[model samples]
Target: MQPDLTVSRTYSGPICLQDPIDKELMTESSLFNPLTDIKVKVQSSFMVSLGVTERSEYHGKAHSGTFPHDSNRTFNPIHAKNKAAYLQNLSSLTKRSDMRTTGVFGHLGGRLGIPNTGVSLLIPHGAFSEEASWEIYLAINQSEPSLQLEGSEILLGPEVTCGPPEVTVSTPFALTIPHCAEVNPDHWTIHLKKKKEQGKWEEVMSVEEETTSCYCLLDPYACHILLDSFGTYALVGEPLSDCSVKELKVAVFGCMSCNSLDYSLRVYCVDNTPWAFQEVILDEKHQGGRLLEEPKLLHFKGSTFSLQISVLDIPPFLWRIKPFTACQEVPFSRVWRSNQQPLHCAFSLERYTPSTTQLSCKICVRQVKGHEQILHIQTSILENERDTITFFAHDDSHFPAQMGPQAFKIPYSIRQRICATFDTPSAKGKDWQMLAQKNSINRNLTYFATQRSPSAVILDLWEARHQHDGDLDSLACALEEIGRTQAHISALAETQTEESHFSYSRQNGL
Candidate 1:
């Protein structure tokens, strides 16, 4: 199939060089108006460059939010070093009264393309002092995905030597192109050219090396073209007429939780333009995952975070499924039933590892004009424990804990002691027990070790040590009144840890 030829250019036109001395727009008053100013003799012509468009003679109304000016060579600025100097000079021009009056200056841009689109908002070097800064800031934050303008290009002088304006885009960069450009089969080669000293254009030396490129027409209104490089000789045709949303991708940012869930959604609109979704409708009907409210409505003013809803886990927890509130302050009320049941529940950090469940749903995003855009989004919801717990290897060195392939999520506190008791289990089950005996048993660390597999010996040691401590303090009246035996003491220690685990996980949203 033939590729589309969507061409964008910088339309340069001559403006009056000198402002009339008695023009009403040039008054000394602070309220300034340039439209009423009269033009005098042109000492030097000012060329204002609007983002250009080469449209088909047939389609008069181009698509909205598509920027064709980015494909133009005449509007490119130089590298960062030169751009900084140009910005500085431009700033000086605005500050100095003599520079404004000494020679003729022209307004370099106008409203030609779609209003509120990239081309309409983009002000080249000839526009204002902060225009360059704004472009740079916009490029970094990229607050809007649809309204992107290539930063100001260095305006060349007659004497300045120059090469072709080149932009090396990744092989899959151009997401969509206009329909008219696609009809011609010869427009696929990624052109490489340079500007000559005499103001003529010439092709750069093409390497015989077989470089690769990709072009995919998404639909009738949009086509994706990936080019290795582009130059002044490379021309595009009119953009596609209809605006569309090509695809939507969603992913879980961190951990999924039964208590609370977080998901990130990225909407890839057609033509790589920034678009604001008027309303996002989230429907949880017929889906295993349930929402606090059915058909949740979210509002956004051109922001990616259109819907961020969190709800407490509502389903009753099954046996063996640790609940988030399983702590001393709020004990887990386990139903005593022998029958096996599925327990896909999130729990306190001490009892279990948080679940990382992936959930997907198709959502409807409404545009400002009541147009409904449907998108499919898949997100991973993570309910991970958020403490940093470290274990020293046999060599007595702190090492990161790792499972088969992924790094283990650490708890809040650091545990870096050697469990020497593991060597001699005669009385103390593990090295951590012996260590706890010497350095008092901290309720939090001991409980953490108990939760993991093959670490029960470490937990036994902690229990033994705590019991020994409580036995020695039996003379206390409170201990006597509690009827706390060694077993009761062990439960107390467990309860203390459960309280700590609940507090830690809830605070950090692990």
Candidate 2:
């Protein structure tokens, strides 16, 4: 009566296709499909759920904005799940001295930074939901051979990582990274690269290109990025022409050879990164070489040019250079690759007579077809009177001490408050410059200006200069001279309070 019907059903399991039926079998079976006999069934109550429905609904109800929807963007769920492990592996491979971590609330937001490293991250007030909180970390790669540069490609900054990549942010965040390359759009092509889940680096965007996912604002000393993702990032430069330039810190270190009469001078040309310079300083200390002068910045261009170093104005009658040629040349690759270690040109000089206790000469450093720097060196070769004065000035018990913010007589909190108060420029002569002058940091104003906080750097210099025998009264007096009596008084009170607490604790043996 219903005309025997053949039914075809689809299942959610593996699908299989069968071969065409034979002509004889088709004819033997009843013809089931007539336009009128076939019936289709539809379920109106069924619903389909996409994976993003929960997130979408939550975002709509909890926040004023929604996540970006780009059909072209592909996200790997597996990668997101394993991101923490990947970051941990990276952290384990590099030194953690420069790493900084902070807890951030979703509703309040917060900032994290590595002090004096020129690296910071700023999260907006509503980057996450009210219930969300995260432990954010920022670190710079400090291990030797941490990164490899390709042909003609130069690393402009340290390899930096901001992680716990599993955490999601609803809004874009700001990241500031410092670079050593001189900004010249015409001669250099700069781009930001991110490490992919597979351990390969992928270019995120060119600083010169226009994009909606991220924006880049280049400053003289740092690069500011507005990005929505968290990962490891680095700034890379490709020299478009020979005119492209990189900034290097040139330092000269010298020591009396074992022979006493023979003096050795070591000239170093390294990337201008602060960490790189600090490494050279540590090495020099181990080798007993004194810094000849304040380090100077050298603009090294992309041209494949060698560096030439020679001693000029040497009293010919008093000293003679040991080399066949007074001037020595260093290859371009050698200096460029000095980021990982200390590379220098050694010059040996012999004094004609031991009576020549004082050495005075001009050391000339020049880049072929580039800039040149002249350093005046005058010191007592035998007695080291300058070092002796410094040594005696400080307590010899702490002879090998490293000076830092902790060494300052001022409490860290008060110093921070002072920096925040005075870092702002004013019409009246009451800014960081005045503060520096008050503290006797009168030179290298240009260098200080290039830092993120000029006042903080000035204080660091003051600490280094007066680590020993530095009194809180002197600093308080200086602050008072600058019309900051309130801050000055507060600093003195806090120091006295801290000292009293320490004494009480010692008496109780706590």
Which parts of model 2 have CA positions greater than 4 angstroms off?
A: 1-93, 96-107, 125-132, 144-151, 336-338, 351-357, 381-384, 387-510
Model 1 weakest 10-residue run by lDDT: 408-417
Per-candidate TM vs. native? 0.18, 0.55
Question: In model 1, how large is the Cα lDDT of residue 274?
Answer: 14
Candidate 2 — what's its lDDT? 0.61
Across 302-358, the per-residue lDDT of candidate 2 in tens digits comes to: 788988888888888899887665788989877665556666788888898888887
Q: Report lDDT (CA) for all predictions.
A: 0.24, 0.61
TM-score of 1: 0.18
lDDT of 1 by residue, 1-510 (tens): 111123212223322224332131123322222222222221111110000112201112222212213333233344665777645533432222211111111122111111111111111112322112111101111111111112311111011111112322111112122221123223222223334436465533221122232222222222222222332222222112223112221111123234443332222111211111101111111222322112222122112112222212223331122343331111111100100111122222211223535444444444344234443434333324232212111111122111111111111010111111122232212234333343333333433243222122232222222221322121112112221232345467789999999999999999
Model 1 residue 209 distance off true place after TM-score fit, in angstroms: 30
TM-score attained by model 2: 0.55
